[model samples]
Target: MIRVLIADDQELIRQSLSFVLDAQADITMVGTASNGREAIELVRKEKPDVVLMDIRMPEVDGVECTRLIKAAHPQIKVIILTTFDDDEYVFGALRYGASGYLLKGVSVSELANAVREVVRGGSIIMPGVASKALEMFARMARGSMQIAVDTQQTASLQENEWRVIREVGCGKSNKEIAAALCLSEGTVRNYLSSVLSKLDLRDRTQLAIWAVQTGVTADPYGDRT
Candidate 1:
């Protein structure tokens, strides 16, 4: 079973999410917290497989909590589920190793699916948030953000791997990448894992940032420099 912890300041949200998610046979609600400090404490004790975090919690906030949780327990996955779609919160949470960033507006089913996806080593970003993220990355790319990549390592990437990276950089999910490349979702997952290892990236969010910074997403089919 996929164990989950909910960290939100609102008691209603915490209870409601717990009630719905616990009903899933594949999921179990391990605990709930009203603030970042409590979230951190619960995480240390419960050690859930996934954490559903809110960004605006008092004490530590979601971004810091994610960082602390990942630092102490790298195997645990944290997904930011907040009402805020602000760029700072989105980028900060992802940069600190959040596996996913989802708005609270998502259906319970979608949220549940996100938890499962992250547990499977996948990243999730809400569609609207994804577009904004890509745009922000593009803007940063145009400015002073420079990501140095190893030429030899990059040269070792296979053509199919390059295709997968490009799609990921474009903010496409495994399902979307599979459809775009006419490959199975499992194949896409493999490619993603390969790319992550090859590039020494922690997760898809970093890959997307690197892809944009390196101009990989600028020309999908163009020559690799």
Candidate 2:
């Protein structure tokens, strides 16, 4: 079963999510928290596989909590489920290793699917949010953001790893990258993990950002105006 924890300042949202998630036979509701601090504490205690987090909270916002959770327990998956999809929060969540970013308006099915995706080491983002994030990524890649790794490390990537990074830069999913590269989904995932470690990055989001910045995909999207 996929163990999940719900963290939101609103009690109704917490309870409602708990109800919806508990109904899923393949998922179990492990715990709930009212704020980021509580969320971190509950994560330590329950050790849930997935956490549904709200961006805004009383003590320790979701982004900071995500950073802390990933730092302390890299095994845990965090999916941001906030009413707002502000750019700063989106970037912060990704930079800090959030597994996914989702709006609170999502249907129960979408929510459940997102949680499952994160547990599978895949990520999901609302299309609108993703597009905006991509636009931001494009700007950052244009030289506004400084890549943390050394130039030599980037030159050491294998050809396959380069392909995977390019696909990631183009916002392709693991399954899509697998199909495009004519490789198995598991292989794509392994390549992604290897790329992250080799680049000394935290997650695919960072890798995607770096790939674009480093010109891995001169035109990440082909034949687009």
Candidate 3:
């Protein structure tokens, strides 16, 4: 079973999510917290497989709590389930290793699947938020954003890998990338894993960030070197 913790300042949200998620046979609610501090504390005690976090909680905010949680327990996955879609919150949580960023508007089923997805080492982003993130990255790329990794590593990437990166930068999921590239989902996942290892990135979120920041998404197929 995928153990989950719900962290939200509102009692209703915390209890509601816990009730719905706990009903899933594959998921169990390990605990709930009303603030970031309590969330962090419960995380240490529960060591849940996934955390459904709210962004605007008092005391520590979800973004910082995610950082602390990941820093202390990298094995635990965090999904920022918030009403806020602001760029600051989106990128902040992602940069700190949040496995998913979903708006509270999502259905209970979508949220439940997201929890399972993250537990399987996949990243999830709401469609609207994904577009915003891509646009923000593109804007940043036009100014001063650049990939900090070694050029040789990037140049060593295969053409198919670049295709996968481009699709990811466009905010496509593995299933979408597979269909676009005419490959199976497993192949897309393999490419993602390969790219992550090649670039020394932590996850697909960082890979997408790197793709946009490096302008890979802007160009068509061509020699990157």
Candidate 4:
């Protein structure tokens, strides 16, 4: 079963979400918290597989909570569930290791699916948030992408490497990439490692961001922002 912890300041949201999530046979409600501080405490003790985080909480916020939780336990996945879709909140939460962002009012079925997908290392962004996120990314890259390109180096990628990078741009996990490319997961990891080395990137997150910025994915609409 997928163990989940709900962290929302609103008691009604907390109870309602818990009721829905717990009803899923494949999931278990590990615990619930009313604030970021309490969420951190529950996380340390319960060690749930996934955390449903709220962006606006008293004393501490979801972004900081995600950072702290991921720092201490990177294996635990966090999906921010909030009413606010502000660019800063979304960007900051993901920058600090949030696996996904789901705007409030999303269907419980989709939210459950998101929790399952994230546990498998797949990142999911709500469609509306995704559009705004694209705009945010394009805007942020406009002035800085050229500098990154210059600093990275004169690097060339193989066809297979390009395939992996493109999938990374789409936020596909290694398992998904392997399935898509008809390659073994081990091979996918090696390809990603090679891409990171050639590009002087630290991890897949950087690779994904860079791929989008450099248009390596060859996405015609990436510049729409």
Candidates in order: C-alpha RMSD to true structure = 1.8, 3.6, 2.1, 5.2
Tens digits of lDDT, candidate 4, 1-225: 999999999999999999999999899999999999999999999999999999888878998999899899988999988655456776677766787678887898988988887775566676666556565455545644332544435346677888887777766667677898899977887887777777776445557777777776675322212
Candidate 2 residues 120-168, lDDT tens each?
A: 7787776657666677568666655656778677666777888888888
Output candidate 3 Cα RMSD: 2.1
Candidate 1 residues lying further than 4 Å off, grouped into runs, are: 139-147, 222-225
Q: Which candidate is the best by lDDT?
A: 1
Off by more than 4 A, model 4: 139-161, 167-205, 219-225
Q: 1-225, model 3: which lDDT tens digit per residue?
A: 999999999998888898899999999999999999999999999999999999889999998999999999999999987665456786678777888688886898889989987887788877767777676557655555455778878877898998988988888877788888899988888888888888888887777778887777887852264
What's the true lDDT of residue 39 in model 4?
96
TM value for model 1 = 0.93
Candidate ordering by lDDT (highest first): 1, 3, 2, 4
Question: By the TM-score metric, which is better: model 1 or model 2?
Answer: 1
lDDT of 4: 0.77
The CA lDDT at 145 in model 2 is 62
The candidate with the higher lDDT, 2 or 4, is: 2
Clashes in each model (backbone N, CA, C under 3 Å)?
A: 0, 0, 0, 0
C-alpha lDDT values of all predictions: 0.85, 0.82, 0.83, 0.77
